[model samples]
Target chain A: MTVAAARVPAASTPSFIGGMSRRAKVIWTRRLVLLGLVVAFEIYARFIGNPRLFSPPSAIVYALFDEILVDPRIRGAIYQAFTEVLVAYVMAIIIGLVVGLSVGWSNFGRRSFYPIVILLYAIPQVILLPLFVLTFGIGPACKIAFGVSHGIFPIIVNVVAGMRNVNALYLRSASSMGASNFDLARHVYFPHMVPSLFAGLRLGMTLTLLGVILAELYVSTGGIGYWTKLYAETFDPAPLFALIAVLAVMAILLNELVRIAERRFTRWRN
Target chain B: MNDQANFTTRSIQVAFLAIMAGVWYGLTKTGAVTPLFLPPMDIVYATFMRLVQTGQFWSAVRVTLFTIAQAWIIAVVAGLLVAYLVTRSRHWTAVMEPLIASTFAIPLTLLFPVFILFFGIGPASKVAYAATYGFFPVALITIAGLNSVDERYLRAAKSMGASSFDTFRHVLFPAAFPVILTGLRVSFFISFASVLGGETLSSAAGVGKAISLAAELMEPARMYAWIVFVIITAVSLNFIVSAIENRRREY
Candidate 1:
């Protein structure tokens, strides 16, 4: 009997009705909870909530098409915000990479500069928003610059960290085989730092978006900032909600794009 | 040798700051950047000294600090509560952790307008905005901390016939305290910064408002004074927080 019991398999196979995988169950439960919350919110807004201060989900959806898409200025503001974020993100990556390399390259440089970099990072950059506007004017230039300022630090930190751990033996062997400094950096350092760089890129996108939005909102003379101010002052909550939703969706999509690229580049780690 | 290396690095760091100051002085002197955009360093220092002596400056600082305090309290309480609830079961943690993290990927700054609408453009709105911003990091980190408790320790507690409350108090809380403290530190900074951002965007009062107000009036000297003060405060706070964290880590 003991031998027979030892040979028997466990009953862990998936069944049709009551044996759903934990992952699937978690997903379904999350979806249901999200749907329920939305429904509850819709009900509250339509019946009891103040229209001027709060908007129902259905009206928000309708306003996205009827109010936002119909207005050319609103469309342009959205487009400008998007363009600013793109420009800022690219600039941040390039500048961050260069600065990070130069600073993190040598022992003396890293020792002297990394603390300064971190100190600068700790200072809330938002306090300087007004100065940026004063310098660059209330244009896309100011917004892009501000965004780059916010986004670059993460990349610099990550790049330095990535470079810190390069295999000494590999460097020794490469140099013994007559590899130049440039060759060692390009071949050994770059590939090793790719994973960390991607992590920075992902975070950089989020911070860049944050910076751009802060600038857009701060300069209330034009663009999405103007519209948001106008809508809030006029108590047109629907368009305001709709506009925010669109921006949120845009942020999510951009973040997802960066994340996908990160996964693709960092596949070797897994 | 280590002490010598440290001294050299420290000297180099000091030199770097001196160079930056020199650059700023040069930039102002050369008119490469206008004094309107970057005020003269001496002028800014004088303005900062003058501002600190005034009651108005202190009031604005007090207001901003008070708002940050309120926001941080709300964030910490709500965040820990949610984290506790979510981490109670493995299933719940798996389901909610990703959801919470994904929300952070979408920049919460986009929600500032809605906050202004509901709470008005006062310190109230700023508090709400900052609280929401601070909540994410605290909740995420706390959940991670709580979940990281060793399975063997938990099993040992269970086998020793300890109650769940006793197990949590003695076993779980101690193990998780460091991470939770880190989370709180991060939350405090996030709250501080976001409140400043909210005031800068739209507010009637606070240090951020004062800076913006000065800028709007084209008073670069005053604005720079406020900015410099904030930078000093932030750096000092960072050092203080790190020291506290290090002290706690020894135990």
Candidate 2:
């Protein structure tokens, strides 16, 4: 008993330190590498890079507040884009869920419409950007429509897959217990589909963002697209870089929110 | 029961397509939607046939295809090299994988303006933009594939005094082949799409530019034709890739 007690500290001590050091090393390396890259870029942009083509990080930071934020029009454009994404995402979830359930619920639905869905999904929807704009006009309506179109396919695919792959035993047992179709859907299918649905949501967010941004850029008359084009044309890299950085941060935040929701919804799996 | 379901589904599929075509014809014939937005189906078909005959269409197709090929090649080489190097160490993998993934999440399209600034409004810009965009999936998937090889196999090979190259050739290559192939497939599509998008947004020439020009010119029929051509190409590519993947899986 005494030997065992004494050996506990000996065994735990090295492993605890080793694990801590390994984690620390990883974190430090990641930070240092990123920092090094940024610093390199800064130096290049300041000294060697063309002013019209690149801006230093410091200048970009200044431009973010002084130039980008100060402009009410730009701010409104950014807000409009954000709203477009939110509305499109919600619409996508609703439509995708309905479509996915309808298509996946029955064998007939799966065999008949799933192929069509897949065919549509496989088409590079970017090619349709012009068509969407022409049909919906050069407004947020077009962007939202485009975003929804991009986002819905993944959700539908994932939900159908989830429904199709639900354990047969679970369904059989539920049916044997005299569960109604509604009860079967609620008790057996919903839980089975949650994780995959969340997976689809995450993908859908990315695609929706891509779609909206693509439309915005394509229009190039107003909104974020116009500003980006304007900056590019006028040889102003600082504000352009700053604006992109802001958008990137927004994208990261949106993605993180979806990831958080995914984790929360899939907690039952653990 | 299965046979009945299959038959029903097949009939439904046919009915659905027929109804869609009918609706298109009816709407155009009734002039509910203007010809400017939704050109008559016949005009679209005629424009497609005419486009097929045009030297301009061929040149645009050639340009886009050439750009995609170059971008995909660059992406494959760079992505594989980076992934392979990063996978050489566990610590490096842990540190770099998330960095790569997070960077990928930032919608690389945002940087197209920067690319334009650097490479100008040409196929060169499209190539660079697409290669940069395509590199992420390839590298990330390759890293995952390489990292997932059975440790026991590696140990056994080491115990048998197998060289690194031999072990990679015999064990690692086969095991990682499937995942890497998936990555390649994804990267190819991404490169294709990004190239098209870049061209659409800002380019002097290409299929995308043609479509954009048609849209600007308010020639809905011509634009629809180009759109049709792109859709057909994309769908065919997808079919070919999936077929190849399935064939590979059977082996």
Candidate 3:
């Protein structure tokens, strides 16, 4: 009778409260501790950091909207940089697609050209930032050029890789059906490559931003680089952190946009 | 890595390089490009050999290597610990994974000035910045590795009366090892690039600084040689990493 009564109590416990494992409890507490640390950092930044070299979350929040937005030049520069990114992205996709198709369509082209692209990509193009400025002369042209150079390779590589792996059985089946070349390529090839092409797009965006930012920082006499250096040299942490936060926001938005596109296009994959 | 094939792929690579060299030689030979803008292949090759002969090139390489080593050590240790903690909870991983990845998405290069302010114009700054950047990949991959252990094996081990440590050591480690190796490979390259970048952007001495100095002094051949050296180093590192991963994948 006592054992039956004990078992009865076990059945009464709900799923919501049932079987709280020790390890899970530990993990929750640990994460709580990390979140707590972030709060503590905010507190410390507010209280301890020098206003010249560091700003609290509160100050940064205010600076970004108030001072940062109020300045037309700063806003314009940010706008210009964003536009540069967009144009470069479009150009990269077009070039990447053309090169990818051309290389993958033939055995000879793939053999000789792909390696050259890979080698060029492997080079730390950041080292050439000064030369870019020297050659392009510090306008948006240099920035766009650098961005394209960095961004296009991954797309090309991925597109080629994507197109190369289509099953021969499918191609043969299509040909056996007397499908035209245009039909085979349009229907069979492009769809197969979309997943990898998107993957390359994501990577290309990352590299493009890296390049644009590097160029901006090197030019130092104009654009975002000018402000960053000015703030760094002058010991004004408020505007520095604020400006960085703005750029960070831009990067996040761009990435999120790409990720959504990736998800949308890759739905047919799984 | 996803699409590497056999000798057919390599032949294309070889032919492409030959054609590139031919173009370079032809252009310089025909004066389509000046020696100042694009030096003769022989001159560049000789300069590269000379750089290798000098102790200065080795010293620069050593400095760069040292920075990467220090950064990677910190990143691996910190990342593993954090990942271990994160994997203990589904909720925490859900909350923090996106946050961490997003933070990584922001080019840490933007924060170099801050690192410089804190650490100064030296290896300390480079090491710190590289480690900060390197930490993201390591931690992200570790989380991925730990979270995606094969459930069947885990359950089988549990049924067989294996302890948590045994499950972790035998099942989890091996399962995640390949992915973690990829993360390590990525971190290594990221560290290498960032370290070089730091030196170029602001540093007292390093290969990056050497390249800048060469450029500033208008020595195109030497600068080209330095670039060639960097390309070789990056590619070889990439090759070694993939080779290790490939061999390990077999087992």
Q: Name the best candidate (by TM-score).
A: 1
Clashes of 2: 0
Against the true structure, candidate 3 reaches a TM-score of 0.86
lDDT of 2 at B241: 80
Instruction: Give all candidates' CA lDDT scores.
Output: 0.87, 0.87, 0.77
How well does model 1 score by local distance difference test? 0.87
The best candidate by DockQ is 1
Q: What is candidate 2's lDDT per residue for A68-110, written digit by digit as tens?
A: 9999999999999999999999999999999999999877788
Candidate 2, B85-110: lDDT as tens digits = 88877888878887887787667889
lDDT of 1 at A63: 99
* DockQ per candidate: 0.48, 0.44, 0.35
User: Local error of candidate 3 at B227, Å?
Assistant: 0.4
lDDT of 1 by residue, B1-251 (tens): 88898899899888888998999999998989888888889999999899989999989999999999999999999999998888877777777777887887788998899999998998999999999989977888788888888989999998999897888889888889877877788889989999999999999999999999999999999999999899899999998887886787785
Worst 10 residues of 1 chain A by lDDT: A1-10
Query: Per-chain TM-score of chain B, candidate 1?
Result: 0.95
What TM-score goes with each of the models?
0.94, 0.93, 0.86
TM-score of chain B of each: 0.95, 0.96, 0.89
lDDT of 2 at A194: 90
Model 1's CAPRI class? acceptable
